[model samples]
Target: MQTSLATSVPSWAVGDVTVHRVDEIPLPPATGPWLLPDATPEVVAGQQWLHPDFADHEGVLRLDSHSFAFVVDGLRVLVDTGIGNGKERANPAWHNLRTDFLERLTAAGFPPESVDLVILTHLHADHVGWNTRNVNGEWVPTFPNSRYLTSRAEREFWAGYDMEEARRQMFRDSVIPVEQAGLLDTIDVPAGGVEIARGLRLIPTPGHTPGHLAVELTSRGGAALITGDCIHHPVQLAHPAVGACVDIDPRQSEATRRELLGSLAGTDTLLLGTHFAPPTAGRVVAHEDAYRLQPVPAA
Candidate 1:
């Protein structure tokens, strides 16, 4: 079922680097609302994720195959790997997906083996699912030779905590395998910049997770930013205080949103959101009191 849908990676050149969206899988009905008790239809309106096409769907928000790709300085890097095969949880929708993320990666021109680095902004199940794949009964790094990058703080916290059962199970299935394979690298990006490649650096944008980081790219004097879960939906643009119910630290998430959005508004910086739909990249604009998304003009 994952292979039947069309995959698109809105591409653009930011100075010298080329970026693409190596999408994994998108849930139909795109949006409505997850099961958050506080979610109000009024608050979710006019959001791209909440397209009118989703009016018939109820109780759950469909997800999209939105992932970021960074091709710079002769290296190909994947910002996040969406939900992969065999991830089991209570949520039937996301339980054990047998996706062809590798095929999707190939469709995007960078086969799994071509990916030099896989950077996970946080340790959520969806983000790390593709870190490894089942190989003849043993789990192995999906991108055989690529280094899997994640935050040290996030790795330690989840590795040694009493988390919700489902999440802990996610760690056991999707994350630990990469560690055991010695393909995981815990990147420390507390400050703003830590070079990952020639022009790519890791920026600390912690909020949703204790060590959440956004990727910053610079080439020929131009810059772009991959905002991982900092702003889940554009509606959050109007109500930055309404952080995701799944966020571990709501107060910190809110503060990160304000600071990240405030700094990127009207700048040359391009913003890429994980759950944001195709044409996932955009610029920020300061609206009435909050903020607004100025999506890249369609090609």
Candidate 2:
């Protein structure tokens, strides 16, 4: 079934902060088993609320790779740079190609040069792809003036991780280049949480990666949470135990999911999913023994 898609650039105001969604690519429908190993079609089909938005009538998941541009206290901050153009990646789908992400960012009123800070929730290939871009012949920081922030644990883990050749190439081309330019800032992972700006902070949500952190925004009386990769899709809200194969620790990821869902359910806090399709921001609601995502009405 086909449904009218949300605007590519959706904006939301959290008290004083303004956020815009910058989409790089709308991924093709994926099978339940492929994206979430334990989620079968029969199981996903039961998630009636996911249809026409997060999933198709046939139970195929609708996912996207995008970034959130946040304007906090007059400071421009971006969360999770999407898979960039012209980068060699371990995933064939992300291999060298061209995208208009920067252009979209510009159109959304966030030119790369204006970004004050670029936060990488984790050092995954997709999350940090746009940290740097291929210039004349050198890899250069995309947001030249922005101070790139990432967790110390994440940088250390990936630095020595024995991964495939392509992933190594990803780090060399996308991550290391930023460090070489003296633009990367490794923050100590917080036990509780640490404030990055006036109303913005990083909440450690490890398990997906050693240092994965979800961004929290609070302004006035409004609150929003950006789930970097801890909760990829709404399906995970229903089956918190169905961990992604890419997660470094599946069990840990599961625990984090349940905790987050339980804490945010029936609250006014807005949940922004990093990979959720259109209408990406929603509110968590309790569903029997698990949870469900109720998309926020478009404004």
Candidate 3:
């Protein structure tokens, strides 16, 4: 079944950079326990700001597997690649997806060939699935001209990772093919973050994955953050201690969430969540002791 939920492409601008959300699939409503084991319905009920968009009245979390495409300084850079088509995923919903992601990407003004850079936030199945496409029983780089960027630490970790059979398959189909195509470039990210382009940098935001990096865009004094699974849902903002089940280090992920959200709270920085549903981009605002996502009004 098709999972692209947005009827139209949602976009926002920060300084000179224009960001567009290209959704590959809309995941079904997941229970809080499935995502954050500590987040029960009672716990989620207290986060009133999550209603309608991030969560339902029943406390089911709304999420999407999508990518944020940034047009920066005449360059097309994609933050993350959503679950691609024709891949065998352990998650049945993600396997063999034949959605109109490419068509929608073109409609959003980003053809695969036109993309100059593809940034994988981390080496996760969902994030890197679209790195390659299956053609004539051969996996090949989808963006032939683009240079794929990922953290050197992340690439090294996955290189030696004793992954489960399913995830190993993901590495083979989605990640290996890109490397084999000679389009992959692993960068040594600095403590202060590495500037991939003028006004755009990859800030290390680990814990979710040991080497996860969030994309920061600053231009003309305006700023926006492409959160690469740092905080999956708005509910997490209200309870930073709650960590995702998939977090490599739950405690560290919680701490990172608090630090990241605390820093952005009360600031004008726009927050674009990688897994957030429609109206995915928002601002972090201080709410009580924690933070909350204030969804930016549709443009």
Candidate 4:
């Protein structure tokens, strides 16, 4: 059985761009404690604000896996494809999913062939799973007509990496198919980041991966930042020191988070968490020494 979109698609207005949060599987409750070990029940309890939305009253965290889709200047763009269906994965939660991801994508008005660009935040398994889909006997590029993009550093790093069999399997099915099809592209995202399309830019948010990126979209005076994997959930906003166990460079990841949060602390820039659960989009506000998200529910 496939999961259906529970409601009409949740969306946000950023100046001229209307971003949509395409539904994917909500991670299991065990995901929170495993992903962020530092965010213990005690720590979660301390933050009285996380309850009802981000965490249970018992202090269990809530996380999700989804993608952001929208059109800007006639280009249908999707940021970070979630864990794909039918892929073999080491994580039980992500293994061989059979959700109606493509159907949901088509319903969002950006069918696979209609997509103009697919921006990869990083090369992580969950983030790049939908890059390809098993077709008959082989994994093939899902978006046949779209140009796939990722930071040059990300690919190069993996090229020289001695990956575990699990990761190698992920690339063979997800990443390599896109590259082999001549659809994958590599861009040099500098410290200041680079603009790929009009009003769309990629900010270098490394440490999760050597060349991880966070997508940014600007229309008129309004702006939005998509946190690829740099910030997994809103809990990170209140506890910047709490790091994901999977971080490649925990120190660098923290620095990037702090700097990124500082820049958007008081501004009206809308922050969209790639793995954030319900009410995913928000405004970053200064709280004590760090920041907290003021959720901007879809309209």
Which candidate's TM-score is highest? 4
- Comparing 1 with 3 on lDDT, the higher-scoring candidate is 3
Candidate 4 lDDT by residue in tens digits, 68-106? 999998899999899999999999999999987777887
TM-score of each: 0.88, 0.95, 0.95, 0.97
Which 10-residue span in candidate 3 carries the lowest summed lDDT?
A: 1-10
| Shift of residue 202 alpha carbon in model 1, Å | 1.0
**Stretches > 4 Å off in candidate 4:** 1-7
Write out the backbone clash pairs for model 4. none
Could you list the CA RMSD of all candidates, in the order they appear? 3.3, 3.3, 2.4, 1.7
Each prediction's number of clashing residue pairs:
0, 0, 0, 0
TM-score winner between candidates 1 and 3: 3
Candidate with more favorable, higher lDDT: 3 or 4: 4
lDDT of 3: 0.86
lDDT by residue (1-299, candidate 2, tens digit) is 01112344678878877778888988765534566877776778888999899888877888889999978877899998988999876566788859888878887778899999999999888898899888898888999999999888888888788988888888888888898889999988677889977898898898999889999999999999999999988999999998888899988899988888999999999999999888998999999689999898534
lDDT tens digits, residue span 42-112, model 3:
88789888888877898778889889887887679988898999999877778899988887787778889
What global local distance difference test value does model 4 have? 0.91
Q: Candidate 3 regions off by >4 Å?
A: 1-7
